[model samples]
Target: MEPIQHKIYHVDSFHSRTFLDTYCAKKPEMDLGEECLRLTMEELHYFFKFANIKGGTLIDISIGPIIFHLYSACECFKEIILLRFNDHCIIELKKWLHDRTGAFDWTHALSFVAEKEGISELSEEKDMRLKAAIKHVVKCYDDRENITDPLVLPPADCVLVTNVLDVISKDKVDFIRNLQKFTKLLKPGGQFLLYGALNATYYIVGKDKFHLFNYNENFIRKAIEQEGFVINHCQVRPRKTESDLTDFKAIIFVSAYKN
Candidate 1:
């Protein structure tokens, strides 16, 4: 296997290696493709049950063009908004997805992840097969406007802020704080669906900062509760990894109400 090396950071190299190796061995069908779809639909269903978001508007903070595709197809949204911090994730993402589309292409999207993660072309076949499951369900846009920042998309009925609360490890506290502040963008009584890798430690491809953070159901439920939201349901799943190690579960998905 081609090695994708990073600066010798704080990660437990030995454990990381064994972990990655193990997951690689039993690569399952419910990989990122299945996982993301499951996560997205779960978010959709949650808002439907606890909030009055249907046929209204929707905002996906820190999401991408892919979500617009989802809403467009469902015709369940009055409008769709995609927001992100102004950065290369947007720049490069725009360049890579320069073609216009009304459908979210999961394959191209996952390819971006595979490439961003530095997996060599030689390993593409493996990832491609796993990505195929979800790729078939999504499509994205080519317009640069889709990737712009400080973007206030169409007013939304529900907001999906998934796995974005944890970015830089060193400032994780502040990151969560900022995420809390960001949540105000939602209208009163709007629905907020949150997801995060409770203890994720990965880098933004090519960037030096190691993004890491941890959160459990109780931890997140309490954190968000103070902010005027009531949890309707929550699920914690072992983050899907290519590693075979058995102990590092990394995600919590929360479906909550914004009061």
Candidate 2:
């Protein structure tokens, strides 16, 4: 089947989510829309173990609070860097910290803001494990700049890239090439862990809709090899839900070593 071509959007994630709900949701329930959420999370644990992240730099590029929460529990990296793809997320994050207007409700940002208000209220009885996961994110916020250029990242002992590759640009080849630019920032023999889902939805720069891309693991692995990194481990999984119109699948436990 020919891949679906979604109308591109150049907005930040929040706006894109809004737009997708309005437009893409027009067809059917987005149930099973995100098919591989589980594999992504599962691969995360695998990455930490494979990279020997303890006592290393763990940089989660363009990763939101979820990654922050998980890795913060590790006590692995001497320093953890949470880099966002855009500046708007940084500003929004800060608002959740000091904004008293109580007008804006960015629930996602709360992961990094709840401590400021001591809002134990942020706790969702439904997901206690999640709420207790990354207490550091609730207390501190790291606002770093652009990630389109891999050159910006400092040398990391391990770099965990999740769901970032297929969303950057529609051109997969170029995206892989761009992703390679990050390897130089890794210390010799350092590790890079990448997790991607099959046909995942992501927000991008310029139009107004949630975009979907089927990330090919072979393409990603080959590109990592081209960049002088050795693939350590890689696996993929298809996720299913109760209302299973479609299955969300993902490539997991993919780790590459920079030699």
Candidate 3:
């Protein structure tokens, strides 16, 4: 199948609600809950392990509205900055933080994270902490200019970039270029948390298919090293279910430091 003609930086069809309801939403009848639980554990294990790393500022450069990984770092970092590709994502984030009507509830995921961390509290308590921890949500992308050139923000101690490179890049060169740009946002020796699908060509969202530049562990390691990052931790999980939402044999997580 031909790839999506336009570069998709964020999920377009159902807005943030589409993503929230489809993946992050907690419905008793949903069959994908186990899959979601497994995926969250796979990704959050690294965050939980690396939470003690010295990082006063954290940056998340992910697409869509999911904030599953950020909760782990809330207690470890003083500030959290969310950078997205468009205004839609920014607005979605605001709606949640500001108590706007029609906002997708993320209490289920927040409570899950807190519980995993041994915190005995409702999701609302976690939500308030997360909201206060998040300092800003701004528009950002690495395509128009060098990744380092676009954002004039402070260098982050830890940068979370997940499921971004593959969908936004046209090919390997483009992916590598963007990777280097993202790394430049970090201070030297800062941690770079990354996650992506292995060999996934496309993923569906509300009947719309988005491209994922197929890559493997070898490619990821090479790209990180070439971009001046030292790999400290890595994990891979095999596909848990057969679903058209995404096609990939494995999900890979990497915790690296800027060298």
Summarize candidate 2's per-residue lDDT along 216-251 as a digit string, tens digits. Answer: 667667778888887867776655554422223544
Task: Arrange candidates, best lDDT first.
Answer: 3, 2, 1
TM-score of 1: 0.57
TM-score of each: 0.57, 0.61, 0.89
Where is model 2 more than 4 Å wrong at Cα?
1-39, 46-51, 63-69, 72-74, 95-153, 199-208, 242-248
Tell me the tens digit of each residue's lDDT in model 3 across 1-259.
3545643644444355665576667887554565555465545644556556756899888767667667777767899988777566678889887889988777677767766777776647677887899998887756556442454888899888878777777688878888877887888889998888798887666766667788899999899988778898888878777777777778788889877
- Quote model 3's TM-score: 0.89
Q: Tell me which residue pairs clash in candidate 3.
A: none
> What lDDT would each prediction earn against the true structure?
0.46, 0.48, 0.75
Number of clashes recorded per candidate = 15, 9, 0
Alpha-carbon shift of residue 84 in model 2 (angstroms) = 1.5
Give the Å error, residue 41, model 3. 4.9
For residues 84-149, could you state the per-residue lDDT of candidate 1 as single tens digits?
A: 442323442343244334222344433444443366763445332332212111122212334233
- Poorest 10 consecutive residues of model 1 by lDDT? 133-142
RMSD of each: 11.5, 8.1, 2.6
User: Would you give me the overall lDDT of model 1?
Assistant: 0.46
**By descending TM-score, how would the candidates be arranged?**
3, 2, 1
